[model samples]
Target chain A: MRTAAAIAALSALLAVFPFLATAPWVMTIALFTLMYAALASAWNLVGGYAGYPSLGHAAFFGLGAYTEALWFNHHGIGAGLTPFAVLPLVGLAVAAAGLPVAWIAMRTRADVFAIVTITLLFVAQTLAYNLRGITHGAQGVAMPVPDFAPATFERPFYYAMLALLVLALLLSHAVLRSRLGLALLAIRADEDKARGVGVPVGTAKLGAFALSVGITGMAGGVWAYYLSFIYPQFAVDPLVTVAMVLMVFLGGRGTLWGPVLGAFIVAPAQQYLAYQYGASQLYLLGYAALLVLVMLVLPRGVLPTLGDRYRSRQRRARTLRADVGTGVSADTGGDIAADVAGEQP
Target chain B: MSAPLLEVRGLARRFGGVAALDDCSLTVRRSTVTGLIGPNGSGKTTLFNVVTGYLRADAGQILLEGRRVARPDPARLYRRGLCRTFQQPRVFADLSVLENLLIASGRRRAALAGPRVRADDRDRAEALLAEFSLAGLADDPAEELSYGQRKLLEFAALLMSSPSLVLLDEPTAGVNPTMVRTMERHIRARHAAGTAFLVVEHDMNLVMRLCDPVVVMAGGRVIAQGPPGDVQADPLVLDAYLGG
Candidate 1:
């Protein structure tokens, strides 16, 4: 109920924002924020919930963007087709690419798996970079804007992107609530134990990897259409991969809203930093340092930290009630409860 | 009665100069509890690992229901109705209690399908949790459970596989007396329901209580195989535990 209420409030706020009343730039920022939030949320399904940190998510995103770009350039396919219609094919391609990597990498453990995924990003980047004739290589593929009038142009794309983001968020929510999500969590907690209990550990991981890649791909495709241009650099950029990871970790990995919050917070800040500082922007570096600090201090991420605070306060309140009943000093009881609750999850 | 559910003949495993398992042979019948007891470095776990396909045997053939099996991987063994618990409880700590059980069920709908768990699987999972007294903590993170509760959750997770044979490696270790008794009851009840168990336990009390036919090993060799009382009387078994 609380989650639904929060979602409702957020949606209502997003529906109006500064844009519905006036400002165009605010609306543009909102659209970009929402899109990145959706991407980060999709990445979280496998990366956060399953505890499989993926550096190769950008590979999926790039694939989707390129696919949509090529289709638009050749077939004249426009935004008229629902995002859902385009999503299935984009998802399929991403999953297909992800399946083999998942199968191979699932055998490796810990840092080895992380290294393998990082290597995959390098391989994908090289392919995208060298593909030349088909991909337009480093030069990038330019997508002509739909022939619609200027005023109507950006608004339709904004709403379309918003709808896609909402769909991605809802899909991620459903997955987290389902059994596969639980299985992935189990695999994360202890792969051996999960296996003992009959988790086809490899298969479960593969499923998550494929799904994550697919959703990321769809988001990428939407992003490409929104921007009307994409390149190899955009697909394989280390910043794209790092940003996804940072967003999830910063927002509070495993929490539903963590990645979305991360995206909204980080993306706009990055854009602003790029605007203000140009190529010399140290915003991302500073953000990385903050993330490290957060991990060192809180470890469980922001949501869990906030949740811990809320729980401690509730415990203090309860203890105060008990103190009243026993005629003990409220201060002492509250202090004790606060101390104990500080250790509680 | 009926033919043994699992038959291992001449199982041998060597790690360079070390003979982890040496020509070990065992038979486990359906609806019975079998204990595999040995001291540290006695290769009891090695034998279990070999049987469950976690480790390959240098020389041996494993037969399940009279079908000759080669080196079976963990997934294959699971599909063939063999499930195993590790010496260390490997529960997914971040997942909820119910989610752990659902994952353990291992009901694969299709290879490329999006999400495979059916509604009935969930119903069955909940029922399994209730049976193991874990239903109350269904939504709790698995890591938050007590040591005993985690063991019970591990058992619940195993039950989801619906295996004919379960390999429990020290299920009673680190559990309290009360929880041990609960575990004993749970094991006995599951045995009665036609699930074969090969239990590797250090606890003699649990071995004596649950396992009828006890097989004792020393230095990777089957030193004795008989009733628990008879095996307990064996000089080799005694020496293995006491140090010669």
Candidate 2:
């Protein structure tokens, strides 16, 4: 109930933030944050829940971005459609692309699977880079300003992006609460045991991979339009992939709010670094260092650590209340009472 | 009495030069508890793996209910009503006891896409948990379970599949005496309900008490097969168990 109330308040605030309503820079930042959060949440589906670390998620993101770009540039489809209408088509395309990659990679073990995924990112980037005639390759294709009734408005675009992010969060929440989520957790715990009990290990992995890819792809498609350009560099950028993975891990990998928190922190920090250093490389290096530090100090990630502390405090309080109710002397022996108090709080 | 549900004819498996299973043949009757006993390195587990399609056989024909099954995939075998538990109790560590049973119940895949587990499936899972005395631990993660609890959970998980045949690889191994007795009772009840069990165990007392007919193997080949009393008295079985 408290969580729901908090989410509700956060949504209300986001829906009517002063900067988002007034400033173009704020709107752009909002859009970027929303997209990053969505993509990170999507990555969490496979990497966090299924415990399959995929370094090549950019393949799907790039595929979606490129597909949308090509469709809008060549087919005259973007003029008539709403973002919602285009999203499903983008999702379908991305899922189709993800199927075979996941099918093959799902059979491999941990480190081997990570290597395979990385190889896929390279393969996908190469394809996008070389397909110049169709994709505009290094030059990138431009998305014509979307034809809103009163011309393309930045505020409306920001809100649309925000809505997409909210939808992604809700979808992620729904999945985690569903039976599929439980099965994925089981698979993460032990694939062989999961399989022995009749969990279709391959099918579950493929499904998670496809869903994760599709969600990330949809976000990518939206992001491309928001930026008004799509390039191979943007589509399959190693930096973007690293940021997504780090955000998910740092935010608290399997927790729903972790990635959102991660995006809010990391994206703004990257922007600040770019502003101060005038070097994108510095931002990447700093982000990498942050991830390494987070892994070293809080291996389960930030959210889980906080959650554990919160749980421990609650348990201590409960024990204290229980002792009071049982008429146990609060401070009988100095040493033992100190030890008990120490244990409690 | 009746034709065996599973018939292994000249089954053989080799690991490089060493024969893990050499000309191994056996018959497993339906609705009966059959014991496979051997000393360490006697190919009991190897033969189990071969029959269950975990390992490929060098030379063999495995007939399930009189139909030849070759190159049998584990999933296919499962679909064909063969289920197994490992020597070490293997439960999904991150999942709850109920979730483990649900995974084992073979309904998670199709039902997973839905918002919630079906009421009927949940009820069935709860009933199974109660029957196995795991109701209290339903919400606890499988990782928090004791070794004996894990073994019981494994058995409960296997039962969720409602398999026609169950291959228990050391079901009593590492289990406490109290849990072992509980497992024995559960096995008896399950056997009475028409489930066939092929148990691989080292505990002779358990083997003698639970199994009707026993099969003995040595160095990857069956040396003797008969009623427990007769097999125990056989000189070859004694040699395999006690000496050569």
* Listed models, DockQ each: 0.45, 0.61
Relative to the true structure, how large is the alpha-carbon lDDT of every model?
Answer: 0.79, 0.82
> Once superposed on the true structure, which residue ranges of model 1 sit more than 4 Å away at CA?
A21-25, A76-88, A151-153, A326-331, A334-345, B110-139, B160-162, B238-244
lDDT of 2: 0.82
Top model by DockQ, which number? 2
Per-residue lDDT of candidate 2, residues B1-244 (tens digit): 6568888999889998888899999989999899999889888889878878778998989988888996766666776778888898888887788888776667645777875466766788899999999999999878999999998888887777688889999988887898889999999999999999999998899999899789999999999998999999999988877786
Please give the fraction of native interface contacts (Cα pairs under 8 Å between A and B) kept by each candidate. Answer: 0.43, 0.65
**What would you estimate as the lDDT of candidate 1?**
0.79
For model 2 the TM-score comes to 0.92
> Which CAPRI level is candidate 1?
acceptable
On residues B2-112, what C-alpha lDDT tens digit does candidate 1 reach at each position? 668999988899999999888888888877799999988889899888888878889988998788776677766786689888787767777778877767666653521
Candidate 2 error regions (>4 Å): A18-21, A77-84, A146-153, A320-345, B1-3
The weakest ten consecutive residues by lDDT in model 2 chain A span: A148-157
Candidate closest to the true structure, highest TM-score: 2
Q: Looking at candidate 1, what is the lDDT of residue B13?
A: 92
